[model samples]
Target chain A: MGGADIERLIALLARLPGLGPRSARRAALALLRQPQTRMLPLAQAMEQAARTVRTCSTCGNLDTHDPCGICTDSARDRGLVCVVETVGDLWALERAGVHRGVYQVLGGTLSALSGTGPDDLNLAPLLARLEEGGVREVILALGATVEGAATAHWLQDRLAGFDVPVSRVGQGVPMGGGALDVLDDGTLAAALTARKIYS
Target chain B: MGGADIERLIALLARLPGLGPRSARRAALALLRQPQTRMLPLAQAMEQAARTVRTCSTCGNLDTHDPCGICTDSARDRGLVCVVETVGDLWALERAGVHRGVYQVLGGTLSALSGTGPDDLNLAPLLARLEEGGVREVILALGATVEGAATAHWLQDRLAGFDVPVSRVGQGVPMGGGALDVLDDGTLAAALTARKIYS
Candidate 1:
């Protein structure tokens, strides 16, 4: 705390997610020990990101590009867009390699109790993107919670005349998971009812 | 993983103490959401610290000044000094508000197995500070562990010719810790032998 600049840096770092006062001290000390390797580079990166980063105009994902990398990637499937609740979810789906289509981040879900409505989300931009044509299907990859479901249902009602098919990700026991002993009864029951023929 | 700048920021942040890839994403999002309040300020703080913070030439604690604030404080006991193994230890002591004396960090301890020796530590500077005179007592406030004991012993031996009353902080059962039933035999025995009068 003796150095004003160091103390300021530690205090600022403490506000970052996952770091508290004690850990911020450790991080500050660590950064100080490797000024060239960690401190300078991290400061430069943060400044650069803060200066340039913007939300993707099409999908509401945080990126340096207005349209975002995924929205502009020519190789990605433009006819199928996956809708999600947040940028974290978009990143999760990207990390999983489960879908090749571009994504749409809702920013948040409709929470009736909390007074969040359709306009509160990034839904208008998504609709505008869809209206531009070429998209054939919309995948609702929202969470399985009440808010997520309500958002999906509302979006479905709004896009009723869009002439594009929309579907929620299928619900069942998770793949490579949900061993009978580990699964809850509702999941087990759903998986059993949705049982399909073996290929 | 979309925008190069955002991705690079996340990656660098992940390298910080207490942060991994997942938390880095969360931090990035948080910073992005409050660019003016958090991101720009934090980046500026880090840059300022990187440029100005330096090890105090007199005591080894980090500060912008050569002699450090603790060394310059007139009310603190100039004749008494607390010795520790690292800056974190110094901070811990400062936080406790127990000592009115200044501090000297050893930087590290002697370790035969790790090939660390006396010259590798901040011992020379400490000796020089003592040679400047008026260090009546040197408190070895290192840990009770073997490495701490070894460092303390080495310092005590080196300071024998100074005619200063060197002392290790008395240790036994920690306050509010190691209840009689919970304490190990070695701690219980030490606590018993070191017990003082009720007066």
Candidate 2:
């Protein structure tokens, strides 16, 4: 029955940022029933991704290689490093197009509540790389939450001995932002709470 | 530069459901920065799908063969046919696990407002299949709206002379359903306006 295949796909898709079982089912059905041209690319992409995707050994970014494309790109500014909590955060920063430096994906932010620490993150390797690679500056692009700031402070302290400039991406709404697509439930809730209703 | 490839991907992704330029850009950047697994699979899938996926000659459903798996399944009950407005609808019905017969996807519903008529849909071929094949019943699983009703009526009148049964799927809240996922603006607005509060 199509149920098994659908269930499997839905479970996999549910793990994606904005999707749940219902949405996953909707997406899977769309792929299954629509023109093959419209959906085959996505399926193939998913299939290939499942097979090959792994964490970058260098920057902790999701990649097929140990060192990601950014790490491997010779033209990129290796001296400048942009530090981010996760791959998602790194992607957001990249889309902004302001950063020309290579990234250091921490894999996760420091969180006492979640029991995440320096050892758990890929920061030591980043520090080792920094010592070897003449990195001049490190930019921290973290969330505005207390935990994010705490992590930033921790990171600054950890790199205190090193002679490198550390900066943080400014907090506020994304500058000159266009309409956001696919506002997932959490973002939607945040937006709703932020909204000022007309009289 | 990776910019052009990122832009091309963003354009394509922007057209997908729930993706704007920002999200598309983010997704594209994610792929670009970590291309080894992501890009390779996506490219492979795109190429393979383009080569292999085709429409079922009998039904409009996407398939590698002329007749889709449902149409060709020997164990399926061909005597009864469930007619749906879209292949997506057919998949929805299938997920509910209520229907046992095969399906006939209309591709779209009849809409006088939108100027969609017999020619615009795959209705003619459906009718032909009904007449030529040993089909005894047709179940209408279209939305319970004006266009859905009109289409159902049109089909009923067209096949009035034939000795067969025509029925509609149940309306109102679905079983195991709460707050339908990522509904269109119109449907979501309507649902919000029509929602009932329980004490």
Off by over 4 Å in 2: A1-15, A25-82, A87-107, A111-139, A145-147, A163-199, B22-53, B172-199
lDDT of 1: 0.86
Instruction: For candidate 1, write residues A39-140 as lDDT tens digits.
Output: 889889888888898888888888888898888889899899999998889988888889898888988899989898877888877688689988899999
Candidate closest to the true structure, highest TM-score: 1
TM-score, every prediction? 0.89, 0.64
TM-score of 2: 0.64
Q: After superposition, how far is residue B87 of candidate 1 from its true place, in Å?
A: 1.2
Work out candidate 2's RMSD over C-alphas: 8.4
Q: Candidate 2 on B73-161: residue-level lDDT in tens?
A: 89888888888887667667666777887887788888978999878878666678777868888888887688987998888887776
Where does candidate 2 clash, by residue pair?
A: none
Q: Report iRMS (Å) of candidate 2.
A: 6.1
